[model samples]
Target: MAWSDLLAGFAFFLMIEGLLPFVRPDAWRRGISILSEMQDGQLRRTGFIIVVAGLALLYLVRA
Candidate 1:
């Protein structure tokens, strides 16, 4: 894989990883509970949104 792609994936993984320790456990559980309540269609739509945002940012900075 290209270094840029590798770095971008690492950055996004770090973003998600960083959130866990910073947020309170109770708050995190509540958030996950809310997420679990979402319909499959809604969850799929959310997944697409996240993918698009990541790709757009990656394309903007590609060298």
Candidate 2:
């Protein structure tokens, strides 16, 4: 894969993350941002879900 593809993926992730504060200002504000707003329990659950989903998607694509 080309470096441009990796850069493009990184840029897309940034654009989505940047828009989260804009779109959900209450749940994610300026000083107390999205990253800081997480509870440890919820964070763990969400992280698990994301990892599972990504792995499942990759499996489906490859299989």
Candidate 3:
């Protein structure tokens, strides 16, 4: 709820987001290319699923 908490979450997200590309740059680029070819609706649904999953995880962890 605090700024510090939000910042910490952002930092964690950055670290996690960086991991795949750091470990396998070619695979990361391939994934990005695939994503770029996806339709808008497909991308939106995928993003929505990810958001819901993240929220579910947060709820379980905080519970």
User: Best candidate per TM-score, number?
Assistant: 3
Regions more than 4 Å wrong, model 1: 1-8, 11-15
Residue-by-residue lDDT tens digits, candidate 2, 1-63:
699987997898899889868888776666466657889997899889999997899689769
Ordered from best to worst lDDT, the candidate numbers read 3, 1, 2
Which digits, one per residue and each the tens of the lDDT, describe model 3 over residues 26-61?
A: 999999999999999999999999999999999998
Which residue pairs collide in model 1, if any?
none
lDDT of 1 by residue, 39-59 (tens): 999999999999999889978
Native-to-model Cα distance after best TM-score fit, residue 52 in candidate 3, in Å: 0.6
* Model 2 ranges off by over 4 Å: 30-42, 58-63
Predicted structure 2: lDDT: 0.82
For candidate 3, list the clashing residue pairs, or say none.
none
Q: How big is the positional error of residue 53 in model 2, measured in Å on the Cα after superposition?
A: 1.4
Q: In candidate 1, where is summed lDDT lowest over 10 consecutive residues? A: 17-26
